[model samples]
Target: MSEQYEYVPHRLLRHRVRDIASGVEGELMAVVNENVSESGVEHWKELAYIRNASGREFTTAVANVVPT
Candidate 1:
């Protein structure tokens, strides 16, 4: 069977971004896609990991970040 999905690195990787809701600014460290299947349906949830200047890290939805 053919593959149903393709995995690609997010454009913001290694770039600086800020969370729109929390006003947190940091370097984008990684992008993670979590696949969810329910009732024969499948979808992906994109998440981002960021590290701040002070070395603090946090996780947030990819949609919440904007280029800094």
Candidate 2:
């Protein structure tokens, strides 16, 4: 018999910035290509993206398993 793996969704998670001073927020994605951050934080990834009224884009910092 062949074994099958249960499907999981990354969008169920919310990624937020570690430093509040950065003024970032949580976001959702269909998938996370990378599981590590540039500074190296465990169980976190930068997949969320944001933008201002000016239409400027900013990359998210981290992810939360549960909504905050």
Candidate 3:
């Protein structure tokens, strides 16, 4: 297990971004990120580690994930 956060306020994100140009459907997972990057490239700067509905851990690009 990478890391699991429960009962904590976090951004719930699902993998497999539809608007993705790669056309890759990803797994369902939660995401995490830094508050604000000085470079302003923070959105796509890093990946947010998350766990899918199936209880599988996964990581996705920041831009590829959205808050739910």
Candidate 4:
């Protein structure tokens, strides 16, 4: 007999700041949601809002798996 496995979902948001002169990047924030998972195995999805020094904001989303 085959054992059934449960799937879990997770959400995380990460931020980074870039230094133009030094060409270095630094992490600003990391947001995690514990209630996003149904089981121990975590599946992650990310959404990012990036602001540039010129005051321009860019948004992006990343997913672990694509659903059809």
TM-score for each candidate, following the candidate numbering = 0.71, 0.31, 0.35, 0.26
Candidate 2 lDDT for residue 68: 32
Output the lDDT of residue 51, model 1: 94
Off-target runs (Cα >4 Å) in candidate 3 are 1-45
* Top TM-score prediction, candidate number: 1
Question: Which candidate has the top score in lDDT?
Answer: 1
Full candidate order by TM-score, most accurate first: 1, 3, 2, 4
Q: After superposition, how far is residue 10 of candidate 3 from its true place, in Å?
A: 7.4
Report the backbone clash tally of model 3. 2
Candidate 1 off by > 4 Å: 1-8, 35-44
Over 1-68, each residue of candidate 3 has an lDDT whose tens digit, in order, gives 22223322344444343214333344544444434434544332345555544555655555655433
Note the clash tally of each candidate: 0, 4, 2, 0
Model 1 lDDT, full chain set: 0.82
Which of the two, 3 or 4, has more TM-score?
A: 3
State the displacement of the C-alpha of residue 59, model 1, in Å, after optimal TM-score superposition. Answer: 0.6
lDDT value, candidate 2, whole model: 0.39
lDDT of 1 by residue, 1-68 (tens): 22343444989888999988789999999877766556667776777888999999897888898999
- Residue 10's lDDT within candidate 1 is 84
True-vs-predicted CA distance for residue 50, candidate 4, Å? 0.6
All-Cα superposition RMSD per candidate: 3.8, 8.8, 8.3, 12.8
